[model samples]
Target chain A: MQIQQLSVFVENKPGRLAEITEVLAAANIDIRAISVADTSDFGILRVIVDKPKEAIETLKEHGMTVSLTNVIAVGVSDHPGEFSRAVRLLADTGFDMEYMYAFISRDKGRAYVIIRTNNGQKAAETLQENGFDILSPETIYNM
Target chain B: MERYYQPEVECASREQILAWQNERLVKQVRHVWDNVPYYRKKMEEKGLTPQDIQGVNDLKKLPFLTKDDLREAYPYGLLARPLADCVRIQSTSGTTGRRVVAFYTQHDIDLWEDCCARAIVAAGGTREDVCHVCYGYGLFTGGPGLNGGSHKVGCLTLPMSSGNTERQIQFLIDLEATILCCTPSYAAYLAESIHERGLRDKIKLKAGIFGAEAWTEEMRQNIQEKLGIKAYDIYGLTETSGPGVSFECSAQTGMHINEDHFIAEIIDPETGEVLPDGEKGELVFTSITKEAFPLLRYRTRDICVLNREPCPCGRTHVKMSKPMGRSDDMLVIKGVNVFPSQIETVLLNLGMDPNYQMIVERKNNLDTLEVQVEVNETLFSDTVRNLEKIEKTIAGALQSVLGIGAKVTLMEPKSIQRSEGKAKRVIDKRNLF
Candidate 1:
């Protein structure tokens, strides 16, 4: 139930994000959800794309430093407590979440949270056992 | 205005100078041959004796001493005089490898200070001026050399070593220090600092004698314009008794070597054949008057040419052009010879700070060069694509100059280490052994 995410190293300059998006558009790869972690000098642009392997190859061909990381996507009911329950479950199990970002799927009436934790497989198992819908690569990419 | 410090020696006729050189060179060779066995063995290995060297023309017959020999000898192997006769020891900055300690007797010190005194006098220093020396003291030769030279000139000497920029400026404005002496980079920094503080008019510096590091003419112009003074270039190395081995006259041409005391030569670095005057080659020096550390035909490794044409300043000593680059510091990447100064020239011409580092590594048996350049505020604020374009521009410039491609990595401001002494500009990680 682990999903592949693309992490692109981007210097903090204008047109960087636009350049990445233009490259993805040219490659016909869709970025489903994107988040940026930024410092003064550079930023890490993390994206859950429809095609992980292809996206990585294209970005690497563009002379960008790119890496693939394993993350878990969870589908939760569109409610405040529903999001907190998944966070609370991981906290209760003593598993630390390194970072997480979420986007609401209005048509599906659910909020999908992408989480990176210390242990991906164990966190997925715990979330599944706690009555949370753990996303598969196929399901997330198809979404 | 008095141009030559020791008019009798500096303005001596060519024949007179040659006579003095031949006499001193013969004495110095015999002195080293008898006292410094380390070099005497080098002479013996070549199957030669002091009797074989009769005059300056026979200098090429002697074996050349390099930094490696200095390291091998360490402290006392090259000392030509007894310890009791030696008065002090001055060392190289030793940024590259082992430190080279040079012993100086009182007479040696006196002559060295006289060389520096000549430099100061050439730069318009006089007995009434206050000479401020900011080169590092204690082990480094710049501060001590210029300090003693300032004293010799009868100037009120301020032995202010490097750093403490604020205090340096304070004294500059307060005491009206007329002549400033330090490394070229530090002089540039002081000019920058003074300009930033709007204290240009307050600074009473009439001349600046800058050396101990390589600086471009553009930087010289920048420093001169900022400080409103004539910046004179001084040349020396610790192996040959510090700054004042040569110095620029008011003519602003090449620096005139103190040929009365040190005999200078240019040689093909690879073949060790002495190159003709005006041909760029590695510089070599033979100390004729130094009593303590009398090095004969010592290889200096600096690449430059000697000019014998009549200079406007009228000093008869042969002048050496500012060293273009060092033979040792030139980087060979992928069969292309690259000097850090070339890259620095490109960056400075592009209106960027010259702070940069060249990292070389071997990957899959191919040498790769990566130039990490610090981005100033102006460049840092540019769009990412624009920054990338700038990197590409720099890479193209470097390729055209070096005949090899290099990866340009833009680093954040203040990321590169700032050096107070000699700047370390290259990091080669290739295991060539």
Candidate 2:
């Protein structure tokens, strides 16, 4: 399963992050998880919100740079070896992972690995076929 | 290697370029004298004939044609050929009365598109690339000019003429558009849109050709950083031709005119004396190959400099910097000449947003200029006092920098209409023409 993530193009400045959050708060869109990938000139503010469509429209109406993307969100055991085993499997399957990060789930003993890979659909299919539980937008947004 | 659609012949050594121009100039003069009634009568009024005009150097002997001349001539009166020979017409839209139109025969259109093709090639476009034409279609020269040129280069074209930013993003991502052509302001808007849609990394656009409105180096840098693409400046007017009259190459210093089809001149607007290279003055152009309406020495009123040095791209045709101001658009306030570009420079230098709309009106016989600038939400916290402070600070800055009193209004971000085509930055309602 692939989760829909919102990536906002934010000019790197002091209060840009706060401004974006303010818009989301006013729209009542709950942010489940967030991370910012940044360079000196700009940043991609990635967000998983309860209402992706509402959050995007609200941010856009407020003049914030935003984009939507499909990313693989895989459930993993909280134990240390979980991430390595998943990576090893994907590597064995010839899937190249661009970048990935982890977010702790509200549910105990489970963590989610948010990954950007070259082939998201095929990776999701293979992960599902191999008994790895793939999280959908509904699960990611709620978490 | 940098591209050149045709070997530049205009900058060929003094003897050869002029000799070639003289031959064509003689033919153009005879054509005008025989076909166009306006030029024929104007020449006759000065007690001159085609025989009196011998060469390109004698261009000054001919009267200068301005936009007003086009308006006076109206639709097809100035056309040198019959309607059957004219293949297309392109017009410029101004807030002032009656838009100025230019005619192009099949040959003229081909030459114009060739000039556009050369501009694209200079900016690193190729047949394998996909071109996204975002310039507004119909009544604007930018869309079709680039469209025809991209087709000539065998590039897949996306004629996505202005507005509907969502669809623009979709096509840019889906088609992997490589080359983008549009006004600079629209490019900035598109950059904002792509980033918001999370499609910045998905876009394959390598270069953007921006023109039609005046933009600053700061704006160019802003767009380039946002979109991760090279930004090139282009210059043209409907009076001469559309967007490919001149363009920026990899050097990015200035726009190189396609002198093989258009003759470029720089003249002092007031004294009318032809200025030397590097002297900032009004730009004038003569259409050498336009058959339907071959305008001779048409004054463009754009203030800029012409560079003759060979660019790294290897085109010898002279290059012109982005126009500093227009002679007719310059405002005389308290006897000090002020152009909108100067205000833009000050606004950008202060680290303020450039989404400003200027209002010039006369109050009690004194000219008053009010600048309404939209505050960037990311920079300004939502507070009335903060907005007031910004307004006061901008007013003080403008007062000191321009040496004139101005009222500054800080507006909500995105409240100012984002321009989809050419940015209309000035609104002189007082001059109600």
Which of the CAPRI classes, incorrect, acceptable, medium or high, describes model 2?
A: incorrect
How would you encode candidate 2's per-residue C-alpha lDDT over B1-433 as one tens digit per residue? 6666665553366566667677887888889889999878888887888887788778777778887778789887789999999889988654223457889889988988887888888778889999999988887788999999998888999999987888988899899999999877678878977887788889999999987766668778988998999999888888777889998888999998877667788999998889888999999888777788899888988889999877777667788988887778765453234667767877887896687878876543235788877656454532233445667788887887676788886544454455685557777654421
Candidate 1 per-residue C-alpha lDDT over A1-143 given as tens digits, one digit per residue, 9 for 90 to 100? 89999877666788888998899999999989999876555766889999999998998777566778899999998876999999999999989887889998756679999999889999999999989999899988988
Clashing pairs in 2: A65-B196, A66-B196, A66-B197, A67-B196, A67-B197, A67-B198
Model 1: CA > 4 A from native: A10-31, A40-42, A49-66, A81-95, A125-131, B72-77, B81-87, B96-98, B312-314, B330-433
Quick one: best TM-score, which candidate?
1
Candidate 1 lDDT, B1-433, residue by residue in tens: 5466798988889999999999999999999988999998999999999999999989999999998899889888999899999999998654223568999999999999999999999999889999999988888888999999999999999999987999999999999999999877678778888999999999999999988766668777888999999999999989999999999998888999999999999999999999999999999999999999988888988899999998778789999998876778765464334668778887887888887989987653346898988765455431245556778889988777665688888765444556785556988786432
Residue pairs in steric clash, candidate 1? Answer: A13-B384, A14-B383, A14-B384
Model 1 CA lDDT for position B89: 96
lDDT of 2 by residue, A6-96 (tens): 8776655688789888889998999887887765434557888899999988987877656677889988879988888888889999998
lDDT at residue A11 of model 2 (Cα atoms): 53
